[model samples]
Target: MNYMISIIIPVFNRKEYTRECLLSLGKQTDQRFKVVIVDDGSTDGTEDMLRQEFPEVEVLKGSGSLFWTAGVNMGIRHALKQGAQLIMTMNNDVVTDEHLIEKMYYWHEQKPEALLGALELDANTQQPIFGGERLNWLLNTIEEVLPTLPKDEQKGLHAVTHLPGRGLLIPRVVIEKIGLFDQDRFPHYIADYDYTHTARRAGFELYVNYDARLLTYPEESGERQIRSDKNFKNYYKHLFDLKGGGNLRDFTRFTLKNCPAPYIPFHLANGYTRRLFGYFLK
Candidate 1:
């Protein structure tokens, strides 16, 4: 039988974080998956370290800076060409639980219609980082309020609207149906959301495996954290408008109401709005 899954990891100059990420992959309990690391031109010894430590992972070479979407596309293309039926794109900074692959695969097997399946990512300090959420209005992104303790330490399952790309698993069928990620609109940030939204529109579902878990490093997170940066809001507002069309206005409002105050809507709004005006000015 073909490989059940391919874990695609795209790395840049962040070898420090990539090291931990690779180690966690090494510790996975499921062995039905192959690890493919796409090094997007790292001058900071990331390539050397991967050569030494993760020789087994298929390494794809790229220029130093292809951005997140491009790098992910490279890795995904390689995985598909190598005969993987499923692809899991993970961030280089996060380390996952051992049963992550097994749980995710089970979810996919049971629910093949789930186009995007993600795990709950916690802060390195074990704080709740991302587990998907209902869109918020004011913040304009998914909210992560309380830390949803580790799987072995958790109770019941929780549902969410979108999946986090940091540890997201996508089946080959879904990718074929929806097409690969859009490289034009998003070089980073919100691109995953755009991809998921497209898949959802195409009759696919997005979900979270409450039992699958991972850890990340989030510098900005806390209660009553007010991050209404005009610059950030304006930039992303224009980005969404250009890509998502006028629907972005309402979409932005939807995001703000669902996402946390400091993270979503505001920051993305600034970025999208700025890009929109810049386009006309030029």
Candidate 2:
């Protein structure tokens, strides 16, 4: 049978998380999708384990330099070559709901032109983590959509300007239009944000489907902190760290690509100010 959807995942050394994620996919009610797991230089025997346990999955090899954007791009290229009608991009750390694909398909059927972003919940708290978001360029901030509302009340489709890359479903047509991610500018973080904004600019609508959800672990605490032991070194390292937005350089690139002319300076200043204050307080 021809696969209707191709699920693309970019993974590193997290074998346990990848295993659980694949297990969840195995339980998905809709079996019409194919999975493409891009192993980006995993030293933890991820490839061996996948071959033994999940032989049916197509495993694409990647050098560590590919990061998130390039790794997913490789998988997307393969999926497109295979003639996939739809593509789903996701992280290896998420355990998806069994009906996620089914619901996403239903939503896509309703609005075939829109990019569908799944609602993500915290694995420990089961509370909404990220669903839909709006970018406040003036304030240089991103606001969560209906964050305070109860989960049940957050049901239905919401049009959003910003969507997380954690779980995004895109039609093949949209990919053909927007093209692949910019790995040089955004190696890891914010690449998803950039892509969504590009799609919106290209006249593709973005939607968040509350019914399609996944459970993801919270980001590591203290990952963004500047250590006091080696103050200068740590501060410098933090400035270029991928998790905390990768310093002023990455922010500058993001602003130039996404922000309006008048707002670029404000965005850059706001980002630098936040990082400076955050480092001092740490």
Candidate 3:
């Protein structure tokens, strides 16, 4: 299918990473996609570098406040205006596989109505980290179940409750209907989760295409909110910070929206119990 697939990449000051990502995209066997990069408040000459090296990529500006969620939305909106048939949201910190587009296109052709995401691997180790994820209320954790599957078994589209924005592909129709990510509530972390959950509620099936894989830098991506080094005072202060990964308010809202109503209280308490305990004990 020679559809107009626009790849929307939200970037900050990571010109090198974005360059590598674009280079990888340039090498794809299926080069039928257009790349729209949202260079939000990049002071590191990222925009200039892109304009020079990757002249084909459409570079869009963002208000300095625009984080990952809003940044991606900027690109998505631009793509929509440009008459894209499919919109694939990506991060600048990843080097996509040569077959990423080809495989995603294949699965998309197979399931046009369903939302698709690429299986993400660690750039260095080549280990699958985020193939697909689901909110496991019983365990009070967001589980990456597809990556745990054996290599031979990870071939087709594995249904998932949520998908990361790393290489998430959505048909233009879905975005036209369901709308953009909730940056006001979840600016960065878990924004993709909330969007996917909303899409699921709106009668869209989400899946991870294992055959469509991309290599991403886990270290360079979002930071750990519950890290040992982060002091309790700072953690509490930023508990509701929009950019903080899986922060309290966003997590609560997501759980309320996605989890079973009966399990919500226990689910939230169970998850927060460890978080609160860890900080207090420390």
Candidate 4:
């Protein structure tokens, strides 16, 4: 079968953001790509804009409350059915380089067995964002506490652990072999982590292509801290339970041996003790 690239953007009441994302796609140097826009029950003007302005874009309407995972799944299925060789699930609030699609597709063709292809995501300042790291719980916690360093310090060429879905490209074979994102464990946060780890277990590589770049709103400001809400915490708890490899016993064993204590208190002291315990124990 001939190959086509599919770019899927999940929209949730972000009409302007969706428009910008689509515009970026339309501006791609590679025009042989199909766009699948999954409107996850957006009441905003997203639907109308797609119908009127973007007739070439495929629009998938949600039944009702479709979160990130479900929305991405919807698009993935559609893209696969449309004979997509490469699938990219990105956020609505992102702008891609004109050459982004072609670069990503080249890497996918080169590394046909890769689990995921990641681009170096930049903030408005065009700084490189870290895609993935083999982080223990303690290191991850410390990373959260440290102030944002210069982008150059964070830049490197390496095989990363997780590929952020914000601008990820997945080979069709990986999707067929390993399957889609785990919506049950992750409706939103950390779905990419679960997907990448699953692929790693299956012996597929995870990579970052610095040449393929895009600008994303990386939750840099106060928005970095999601609002304090029980629903959000519930989402995270579900994420851990669904994503964790083992129980508290396993987590303790994994952490004490691999994780450092200094970073734990440094980054996550403000987190609730119960949350910390659950994360550490689980």
Candidate 5:
């Protein structure tokens, strides 16, 4: 049977997280989807585990250099070759709702040209983490918008300017027009934002399907009360690490490529100043 949806996931050494993510996908209410997992040179026995346990999943191999963007691109190409009607990119760290695929398919049926994003919720607390985001072009910053609708609010699609790739669904037609993620400029981070921006520029609408939700764990740092580390050098090194998507160089590249010409310098200056301070300021 032809697959209606192809779920593409890029993973590294997170064996446990990958297992849980695959388990969640296996439990999805709609089983009309095929899973394409790209293991980016994971030496942690991730490949062996998937082969033994999730044998039906198509595992794509990647060199250590692919990172996130290239890994996802590999999976996308495989999915396209398999004749997937819709391609969904998801992080291996997330546990999706059982109805997530069903809801995504339903929403796509309603708006075929729209890119669908899932409502991400905190896995531990089960609270809504983020719905969608709006870009502040003036400050060259993206702000997360948490929908404050009532508990009984009707479940429907909401328009969004920026959608994270954590659980993004795109119809095959959108990819044909907007193309895949920019692996060169944004090999790790900012590729999601760039792709969504490109989709919007191509006249494709973006929407968050409230009914399709996924659970994600919060990042160790950022707003979650950072721990004081005496080793400032190591701290700074990790903070500016290109793999984690916090480096000033990558940020400057992303800003200059996507942001307005006049605001590029300000965006770079502001980001650099923030990195210099080493502490997030309110």
Candidate 6:
């Protein structure tokens, strides 16, 4: 049976980025999909812009509390209600090839029960930034594995442990089985890992389609440190900040949720403590 496709984007205030993302979607080789924007209290008149610019796209307003996870959940809920059999979640700061959806659909049709991801390349250098990832809890390291995969897999879809929410495709059955992202524990950060890991445990395969390519502004990602002075105060400040990459609270929660019971503490200490050392000692 043919499935209705929906691409869901969550935007806070980056209106220009959202505009560019929408434009790329419009130029897709396959226009057999709809767009949904979950605007979580964008003070930059994003709502007005969408109304004036792309009125055909649906906009859902939130009370500013919903961050990435909740916003995506909101979009998925709406999409499901609108008869969306397949849902794609993405970040706004991205542009795509004209055949991105077509390529993703082509790979997804081969194994419909799996979670599919689009290859994310850096917008400037055209180097792949994110394609697929393997989380090594023993070493507490996450490696970008798509480029190093077997050639056959490179030409096709590469199986993975988890896929980021950026340009991730979700079949309706996965949601029906595993439910939505755990927004309460992972509102803004680490939510994608949690969702995909959960889906993997629930018997869903994760694959990244290298042929489905999109350009993302890697420099515009979450902040890493407050300063280079190695000030202890700055380290502590950014460690728990929701928008920073060193979100210790969220990372700890993610480890506990995704890792095996015996490995949770080791993963946190071995991975984060070492990384924190770099932010301070280095």
Highest TM-score scorer: 6
Model 5, 124-164: lDDT tens digits are: 99988788878877866666556556666626787888688
Clashing pairs in 4: 248-281
Query: Rank order by lDDT, top first?
Result: 6, 2, 3, 5, 1, 4
Distance from true location, Cα of 139 in model 4, Å: 7.6
> Model 3: runs farther than 4 Å from truth?
138-143, 225-230, 278-282
lDDT per residue, candidate 6, 105-158, as tens digits? 888889988999888878999877777888777776778886676656665687
TM-score per prediction, in order, is 0.73, 0.91, 0.91, 0.73, 0.90, 0.92
Please identify which of the two predictions, 3 or 5, would achieve the higher TM-score against the true structure.
3
TM-score of 3: 0.91
The CA lDDT of each predicted structure is 0.67, 0.84, 0.82, 0.67, 0.82, 0.85
Off by over 4 Å in 4: 121-123, 136-157, 220-282
Question: Can you write out model 1's per-residue Cα lDDT over 111-168, one digit (the tens) per residue?
Answer: 7767544445555466555656655445444455235455464422354556657788
Please provide, for model 3 over 48-100, each residue's C-alpha lDDT reduced to its tens digit, 9 standing for 90 to 100: 89989989888888878888888988888888887788999988888899999
Residue 145 of model 5 has an lDDT of 53
Candidate 3 overall Cα lDDT vs. reference?
0.82
Better of 2 and 5 by TM-score: 2
Which should have the higher lDDT, number 2 or number 5?
Answer: 2
**Displacement of the residue 203 alpha carbon in candidate 6, Å:** 1.0
**Stretches of candidate 2 above 4 Å error?**
1-3, 148-151, 221-234, 279-282
Clash pairs, model 6 backbone:
none
Q: lDDT score, residue 11, model 6? A: 93
Put down candidate 2 lDDT per residue, 32-61, tens digits, no spaces: 789999998999999899999999999999
Best by lDDT: 6
CA RMSD, predictions in order? 7.8, 2.5, 2.4, 7.0, 2.7, 2.2
Superposed model 1: Cα runs more than 4 Å off: 136-158, 220-282
lDDT of 4 by residue, 1-282 (tens): 257778888887878878887888888888878888888777887789889999988888887666778889999998888678888888888888888877776766777777544444565677656545554454353232112434454422247656678778788888888899877656665577678867876778887765577877765322233222335454354334432222233233333333356654533433334344443343
